[model samples]
Target: MTGHSAVGWVDIVVILGYLLTTVYLGWLGYQRTRTGADYLVGGRSVHPIIMAVSYGATFISTAAIVGFGGVAGLFGMSLLWLTFLNIGVGILLAFTLLGEPTRRLGHHLGAHTFPELLGARYQSKGIQIFAGLLIFVFMPLYSAAVMTGGAVFAATQFDVDFEVALLVFALITAAYVIPGGLKAVMYTDTFQGLIMILAMAYLLLFAYTSLGGVSAAHQYLTGMADLVPAPLQAMGHQGWTAMPKFGWGATGYDLWWTVITAIILGVGIGVVAQPQLVVRFMTVRSRRELDRAVPIGAVFILFMTGTPFAVGSLSNAWFAQHGPLLKGQVVKEIDAERGHALVGLMKETSPGRWEPVINPKTNQPATAPMVVVAHQPAQDGQGAPVDLVSGRAPTVVYAKGDADQIIPTFINTALPRWFGLVFFLALLAAAMSTMSSQFHTIGTAAGRDLYERITGKHGTEPSVLAMRIAIVIGLLVSVSISYNVREEYVIARFTAIFFGLCAATFLPAYVGGLFWRRATRVGALASMTVGMLVSLFWLLLVKAKEASAIGLVQLVTGGKTSLLADYPNWPSVDPIIIALPLAMLTLILVSAVTKPSDPQHLRRCFPQYAAPQATTL
Candidate 1:
């Protein structure tokens, strides 16, 4: 636990080599890509395995490995459920249910982008253009969160400035992605995905071996139940073994509501409609390839998502055993701001709850340790914040209380230097792979879907150039937003927010358009609008993190609580749970009452009915 661990020259050389290889792949992609279709959808020729890996890599970025992994450290093994859902919903159902038809119709309509596909499906320019606008606007927030996660890890590992790491990341990613487009992005993603898989495999082995084994680690964590932070215990944390009880637990309904609704259902169900992930459905040659990809994607998701939660939870055990390593963590500003030096010398002035931390030596609050803390909204038997207000709390302080650093800190302190470097490359790969896709999606959405639709003009060369410009704009916007965000958890929250938003705004129309022939333009439009707006309102005014940051809820209520104060757990309810159902209901009601789309349009969109055999012979 020194000030900073030095990266080896060999490690530096390896990273440089990886970057050069990525650039070379991009050049290859650029050579292959002649038209907008090749750039956007890889000419619908991406191999199933490559497509599957690229999709998983894009789906699970550093946000999953670093941000959400850190959450696993705090929340425990319950996150494993998300991994299962990822396989079931994100990969299996998405591919089996949506992928084939999307690919068929997308190819049939010559729709190069996701928004364009939707527009062609519904025959509505507004749906296509507005979808593009949403991508241009909200996608940056997600891209920024991905950038922040990678930048934080890179800065910590390389001992470089955050801005420096971010700039280098942007440059390296933009170099390949801006020029080569989706083909290049996928090629590199395939490579990065392999690296990620290897690194995670090794990470899992190391994590378990370091703790004696999987069983041993779990046993140790279970034995150390007394060490589960008091606030967490109050919130129904049951060590690293079991799921928090659904209801009537010691931790009560708050933790249950938050975990089930926001983290689990929000992200789990949301992945089905994620544009970046969904776009992969169109990357391959046919439904057969999409079907072939399911197993590959399942394994990839299993390893990437499963390993992190397992390793992250076990790291809590490692940190508990080795307190000194905590000092090496890069203390986030939020944690630093909350730190206080005071350690009160209680003289048993009361029978239960003691006074706040105060230095007896100076008769005032000390400022050296700079203690930063948050309390769970729960009171102990004595009516005080479990251990935060003092009563048999551990005296030793971690450098940062922010849970987001858990994985990075563990990697830096616990892993071998060379392995850590390999892991860094893996993380960099994860971030860049996802970021490139995000930027590429943004480029295509804005350039092809929005700008071209707005002008009612389209051409390959001009559209390519416009997308390249859009890529640059996307990089700038995401980087700027990255600088403003400071919280570690917010990185994960942003992903959830975007996922929920995508689910709300896109899922209903997307499903209906692909299946039901009755879905009309008005219904689709209304669903998108209502779902998008409701999600925005919930995130900005109901959720604690964004709501507090925006301060709109505070302004209106003089409290952090959401608009639905009648329900105690309203704030914990994820927007997706609320907005997605409303969207579906609207889509159904409006489509039912208004008018069905033209039969010709349906016949064209669903070619199964108009097969060669159906031709009047």
Candidate 2:
């Protein structure tokens, strides 16, 4: 197999044309904007289709397609469970159970942001301020993850520097979001969602067809169970077509815990509390619109998440059949500074195709390929590297297959050149749609929720201007993180961190405020604070993946990867598993004892229920 070339002039022209169209749509949204409400929530009059597509687009970003899709490449089709949860929980349950109440509450209280909704319901400015700070501070980590996914693919497809791609991507998104606000964000999201559907549908069809259909692909992938990397097998990997070994109180349950607790439940449940997604509930004028949107959003999520997972897993079979083989000698060197062994030798002749490096002076391939594998430390801290394929000490690693690069490599090498241009645009759309919403949410959290509440200045124009400025600041923060964060396969990890944090901190309080009339201001505040603190404590001290990446645990413990490193399977458990239940328990216990909110405020928030009860009496 040969390498894919950098995008050609025709591709460049098509991309520029797409950008111009997006600019025109942004201008249309800007023309429609009139007041603070218009800027924050599209004047609460968005069409059902537009609202649904915007919600799905905001929910499914490059993080889903590139990040988690790459994860699917490493882990297997077991990721399909996440796609099921995305539709069942994220779309159906969210829209049916929570959407109407949130919309009614936001409308009745005149709340434009998620923090404002919580603050207004609880009648506590402190809650608003704290939530706003949380969002402004941590959301950048997730934004940077999304930005990294887009920049990685762009860098691969266009053959540009990753930093250059990230900067350009951020600037392009800021151009539309700062001025057009929610209106432009939704309009552009609708357009982008359409592109995503088309691209994913094509990719899914092509993957199965190229692999001799569904059964053939799965059968072949199942047959390659022996090809599972030795290290992965040691960690309980069964095969690409089957679930990881599942058990508790044992060492080999690491993969099972990671898959269930971190990947599936963390992201699946966390989507319900995402500020950007919740705000979309308030975009439409009525509950009827939400009902109309349910099916559209469900179908959109299915294509958005399902296609990527399926295609990502199928790529393993495609690569095994057609990918370039490594032919080289083994060489290993220990790097003392990073504490990892540099092993293997190979060179990329194209995006996904690897071969021996060519000697420029001699115009011939090197006698031995020098493949630079990602840094993976020995389990014993001995600085000995294991071969990815054979799981042997001090052997040649064949391919530079980072989990983050799997989807991009497959797209570039396995698909047709024309499809590359289409997928690039689709990925750009995925990144831009989500980034615009994120920047918008972060700005509102800073300007409308934090700054206005702090200064006691509620004028519409001032709030709008402050939000625009905050959007630029947020962009800078996310861009800087994207440029500087050096963790490998970080897209999925950072995404899970943000999502799990939001769920643990905000989900209990937000749900309580909507349904439990007796939920007190103190209870909401306490639940949020405890949830945030516990989640952070767990991430920095106990969760092995995040703890090691953060290095805070190592710094405090003098080289321990986690506080519970010796405890079996504890380090692999997601923070959400521990923190969310505690947070909910706190909310329930505290609310049961504290004074209930004012009856009149509850009446206004739940007017539909209030009238029914009043009539019955």
Candidate 3:
């Protein structure tokens, strides 16, 4: 039997059984659902554990697994620090600080979408409309990011065609989501969350031990001190020991800003304003349920994010050791030749076919490098062994032709075939877990924001059916975007860009509406509008350039003039830095300029947790 399929049929049955059971429960949940509230918000009766898992699934995805992890492997461990903040800033502070108020406002105002809540709170439909517009525009991009992550992992690991893989995953999500709505989504997310956490934990421990045990792996990493640069060396970045040096690019300012400040805060802080996530706050039976959810959410994040960060940081240095020659001139050449040589180096270092090195120091029981190679036909009795150091000719080419397909490639090679199957299934769970939730949220917003608002409808069996249909449409749109995303665009980039946009646009209105009584209707509109435009403008208008004697654009983009011709070098700060304050001030100034909205009109403006049991200005 080829090593890839070594697991007996039992593993397949167990994994598929798990999937079927979860899907069935989701369907059961759909059956029990009776109203728009139930379909959209689980009738606002969700348990804390369920909500916690759902939150975890929503936050983490293949982006965390492959996209971010891949980059961490390329860069260094400082990236992992973002995970710490994900829990502290994104989840913890969000839940403790924002959850109650957001939920209260949603209930107080009898709102559903973030827009609806904000509009009703501030006594302005315009706010709701603007909010809806922001979400409708930006959410799809977020979905595309998740899809990008899935594609990268698929292409690298299972060797599936990128488009094909994208469609498969997207369609699968659409199918389940379209039928079941949020109930199906939450149910599946609960299951998928468990699988993701388990998979990451298992993979980390297994890989750590398999690579010649933990102690040896540490020594191997520490011994390769020469691989890191002097600046990096000073900061403890010994390829495996510590963080990367602070700089402009690479493990520099961009990463810190994007990951810790922008993406993390945008995601974590922005949760208060996320129509999809905010609605989840309404799902629970009571504030007590929300309170319960906090700890579970924290633990889930600790598991999901912590494992990936750990693996990503340590594995990055590990891959580098077996990766391309750590040379400046060679590293800058962006050609198929560089890719080929790297691939060769990767192939040669591959232990156990293409598994990760078990131990760098001893090389005893050394596993394959974490890169997958096409299994060519056997020559004689021996399968092709990796040649780890295939420098082209006179210049050590370092395998002369390999790749950095560490995540997927390693998964395919290292585990027993059955375990590989389990790993893939688990990965699917991770993808679907979040994808389902996104589908549910988009549908709910459509139903509540567009359909409910347009139709003036509330709870009903038919409305639930309408929400189901909206789910179908939302799934279709998200999947389509995913299908179209280019292979070059990574998961982290896509997700971060959209999320950054959100932080820039929404955070202003959300926070201001809550705290700034001066926020006027026009102010809310302006804030949302300006924030969105400013964020997008930064990315589109600004151009990034490297320092060069000639010109950065020519040096990097290979043009006679400059790189900005193709694309501008935006600072890539999570637009929140500029957009948030501007949006807030816009809301305040606009409100102050306009007549005060009738105080009687205020009832619909705040959340349930805010100032009202009955809700009047």
Candidate 4:
């Protein structure tokens, strides 16, 4: 911890190796792609297992690793509930209920993009156009969020410039993606998935071992919890294993209400709405293949989400005995036990058992014992520690209020230099693999819906070239937003927002056009229009704090909250909550008021989905 190894030759070797391996895989995929269909949908020949990995990788992004994992660090293991939600709602329900039907419909319609499926099923150009435009706009915002997360983590860990890291990420990802297309993306996603699983396992075992197994670490944290000083301890502070008791109860119910609802529903329902992800279903050969792939995707999602949640929970103890800068902030940066927890865990666990070697300057083991001086005596009711904060011992777990960079900070500190290199390579792979999928999905949205269908015949080879060009255009635009824009948005936050809009607008219309026999073109249009507009309005008005805080006058009269609160603003009600309901109501009532889609057409549109699920949610 004292004299850490700056990233050296081994680290550079590890990164370069990953880059070469990725670029080569992309080239191999390109060699396999011969036609537009092959390139766009992997020739509809991609094995179900490969397709499942592609789907899993896209879902488990930098947002999962860096952003949400860090969130777990502050919020505690309670956030681990998301793992169940991912496997249960996102994977199980999504695959068993939605996957086969979507696959059958896509094959029946010969669909390439999500927009095309909507257009083909109902025979409506407007629906196609509307869906295309939605992808063109919203998908980029999501891409930018992922890019920003990769850039920030790279800069913090590798000593690279932030913007430079971002641009490098953009360029390298584009190189492999555009040249090879979906096949390349899937191959690379599969490889990256394997590395991610192994790296996380290694880190988990190392963390527990370094902390003197689970029991010793728990004891150390509990002892430290007893030593927290007063005043500081009055605020929320507790050990890693214990649920925090800051009057907010175990999970801080109010905040948890919003987070759990947002994420569980966001991811659970959101997985269905993702245009990019859904298109992958079009490539599967059969319902059998989809069935075969389900277990693979489920296991991957479980490990990817579960590993990070576990690591983040113990991060408090990891950093305490290793690095305790605290940055001299007024609110003490971290709660007494939360801040100290991580380092203390490391102190108890590490293999190169910590010894106070003489500092040469003072000789005689420097000033004092490393662990004892930092030992902090037990605390009383107010939780004061004499040495660390108050007279009493600190809590076992502590929270660093701000959450942007804590997880990466500890990994960079605790792991051996070589392990850090592997992790960096693994993270970079996460961003690149997912970005490739994003680019492919967006390109397909343009190529099939806007370019091919409208013209009757597809655009010439040049039109296909234009699709490739659009990928660059999309990446540039998303990168611009990632670099220059300063918005108050989290990756998952926007994902849920946009997803709710898609579900409200598309789910009912898509279903009705295929099975209900009650959906009309007019109603579909109304649903999409209302759903999109209401979502945007809510985001702009209700979601932003100042707009809500000041009410109507302040919102209209040049809002003052942006500069004062530095919120950069947020859109309201998270779109899905309200906009979706409105969209569904508009679709249903409008269908009833007017004419239903042709019954013959409805049967052709969905034979399987209309047969019905065994039960309702």
Candidate 5:
């Protein structure tokens, strides 16, 4: 309630104008779309700049800006490693090493979707159907993550109900995607990407300027190490400007493992196998187009990802200096039942009576006061208890201080009134661009790869119509999941889960088919199956965070959080670390033992290897 502020008429007009222009572009794409190819791959003639921007925009979603940015708020500047990987692995290697081959193979096989490309390379309907089903089923989790990030910002910005914001956001994105397909998605993505670049640039400049330049801001953040919550410190948090403790803390390398394995590597390497992003390579006409796109894509990613991470880490400095103050008293009394000290923050208006502290900004009772309860009363680490008699401390509390709302709270409270509107538009663009691509990919997976292949209906008209209907169904599933998924840092967690799953399931087989002539259909199939099952098994029974949230282990085992809860660091390890290696080994062993692919098929897939050799007479 304290952060709520009504939008001005000017803001409303600008939002309406942007929405109208987006709708017009979608209509234009609909008018131009004439074939299934156009709907799925934009006729394979998209401009390099547009394609690059679309790929970058789709790759960097609200999940990046809001969800992972929030994670940066807790984990600090260590998240910047992900940005490095985004440029190196996601753009450089992806466009050069993998992009050209994926484009050529997709064209050679006349494939439009990612699953179709892999299926054609292996020449197996089972592979195609399995890949399609995998995508259509689990992709909703990612779609929901992106949607939740957008809705969280929207709800914070407009003071509207979260359900309403989510529903409207989904509808607006579907209006453009279902009718216009990939063409509309790319066309609108170009515009959205530009907006994101501008807004993020402004935010970066503003955050640094407001905090007294880069060095001073970092110094301030580093100096506030003691401000890290006790719970976080025990888990390995060192400070806002430094990485978490390396090997062990109270929980035995739990934070270190989660950061390196689950967050950094899980999403960093996972981008290579993302079905939504891989399909972008097939949208361009030639390798030259892909070549031209590499730098543009790299620069786009650098700004898109780098800005949020820097700003998210620096927000603690700004909040500590300018955030609201809380007035309360720290009470420590012995509990009769437990015979231990009970410490809490309370406000007393009359002697022998206490009430909840009311925030002056909102005139509402504060939910989470800036107090850490322990067996003994909390201390400020300076050897003095935290003002036990008159607990008046300058505290930063923004809407429960939830990680998902950190960026939103900063935008709304720390910046000028007008910039809030601008940032909101940027977030809207981010959410829509990513959601459009996701919905489009899932639609093609269900309609073209699964339904058409299974039912033997390959006609253009029915395929296009089926894709349109499938988009609607996919949206419904995503929205339902978004509504039901309520957890702290849900966006970041779900994004990592989906990315890890894709990397484990698809990376081994996709790379093998493209680069290795000996990769057989059976090998690819076996790898995909093993990768997917192994990843799921790890998520449901091994990884502590996911397994505990899902409650599957708890239900099956009658109260265990994970299968390996007794182990030191196994529960914290990501599925990608465990499953990706096993998957690669499976592909190699199976392909080596099994018969190689047909010579003719290998010739078509690897043309350079098949080039006729000149013999000397």
Candidate 6:
């Protein structure tokens, strides 16, 4: 069989079983869900274990696996720090500092959605409507990015069309989420999370075993430091083994900033304020459930996030050892044209062919270069061998430059077929879990939060129907976006952009509302407005991706500049680094000058403050 063969019947049966089970559980959840509360927050009765797995499953999606996995393949093991930050900041600190209070406040205030919580806390309809609008408008970008990650991986690995892959995912997620609501979403997530945990564990072990164990892999990769591309080296990539040096000095500042600020800090800090994740805190019964959820969430994050980064980086070493040899015809061509300017030196000179390489140390060409060619075997009797060879191409592999293809290629070429099928299922789970949550969140913001706030209606029936409609609309928008932004790198960056915007726009006000009684309505509104705008401006004008995509930067600068066009060039920096502090400062400064929030309101918001204090004994 060819290396890129379709999955076997055994694999197809396994995948079909997974889908049927997910749909069946979703139907069960739908049967139990009757009220808006049950639909939006799982009636706030979800178990701690289920809540933890659901949160982690929603948090780490195709974006983490297929998107950032590609980044790990390019940038190396530095991505592991992101995994640590995810566990430490995203889970541990997020639960300790934010979870319990969010639950209490959400319950006390009768806030099922994030915007409802903000609106009720600040006593402003404007804030509530605006918050909901921000989510409805910007969240599709993130959903699209995640969709692209999974679609691309499926297309590359399975030989399926990308459009078909996207359609299947959208349909499957909508099937469960629209009818079953958050309860169904959680149930499906729990199952998906189990698959992810198992898939990642097996993949990590397979990676190590294929590379002759962990230490040998590291040693081999370190020795191949010379193979680090010139462009990457110029940008301060020392090797895959070491951390990139920080700051704008002899070491490349661009690499440092991209790794540290754009990825690590952006995703890490952003997780605390993520509306989807924050709402997960409100899903469980009490502080005890949330407390129970912490360690499971941590371990799940460790496996799902850490495994991919390690596996992706180590794939580089595996390719170095087992990749293809040069074809004889191409080697002859290179020899014949040795003194002339070589065209497509590294590229295939002919289809399914490549040239010989000169010995790097000796600077001399080798004779009898290894190449795979079809030849007839000697017949023992009157019988003759078949005219063609149809087995796998053992020496036809090459280093893949497309970062998005790295993990998918490795799975297909370096692992057993059953393992490939299992990993594909895991990726499908990642995508569906995340997209379901995102679609549900978007729907809630639009239908329950915005529609009710705008219409001044409190009917439960219409609100639920509106939310279901919004889910359909959200899926359509996200699919359109996924089609438009097809490049994996760009899709991955959009994920970061959404995270950065969330941090900038929501983190300061959300945190302050929980802690500081002095925070004012005007302060919260201003922080949200300024933070979101600044983050968008940075992405659409200052950063190259959206700037080039929109061309606004070119028009404003008369084709000569951008917001950062004349500024010193450094690593790609996430807007969160600049916008988050500014948002906090705006909140604090505005609150300091404005009238204090109503004492009654403050008392209502902070239940702990309302509790009678014991007199000193």
Model 5, range 1-617, lDDT digits (tens) per residue?
23535767998899999999899989988998998889999999999999999999999999999989878877788899999999999999999999999999999888899999999999999999999999999999999999999887887688677788899999999999999989999999999999999999999999999889989899988987876765677778888788878774337357788888998899999999999999999999999999999999999999999999988888878766654222233333333232222222244457755666432222344333222222223333332233332334432222233567668767876788788888888989999999999999999999999999999987644479899899899999999999987777789999999999999999999999889888899999999999999999999998988999999999887898899887777898899999999999999999999988889988888887887989999
Q: Model 1 — TM-score against the truth?
A: 0.87
Q: Which one wins by lDDT: 1 or 3?
A: 1
Summed over model 5, clashes come to: 0
Off by over 4 Å in 6: 249-251, 324-400, 460-462, 611-617
Writing each residue's lDDT as its tens digit, candidate 2 over 283-397 gives 9999999999999999999999999998888887876554323223234334444333333334555665556433221223322211122323323223232323332333222
TM-score of predicted structure 6: 0.88
Error of 6 at 393 (Å): 16
Span of 10 residues, lowest total lDDT, candidate 2? 366-375
* Candidate 1 residue lDDT tens string, 109-196: 8887889888998899999998999999999999998888888778767767678888898899999999998999999999999999
Task: Score residue 422 of candidate 1 by CA lDDT.
Answer: 87
Better of 3 and 6 by lDDT: 6
The top-ranked prediction according to lDDT is 2
What shift in Å separates residue 407 of candidate 3 from its native position after superposition? 1.7
Q: Is candidate 3 or candidate 4 better by TM-score?
A: 4
Worst-scoring 10-residue span by lDDT in model 5: 368-377
Candidate 4 lDDT tens digits, 468-574: 87788788888987776433335445455656667766776765654565678888888888888876665556554324443663556465432222332123124
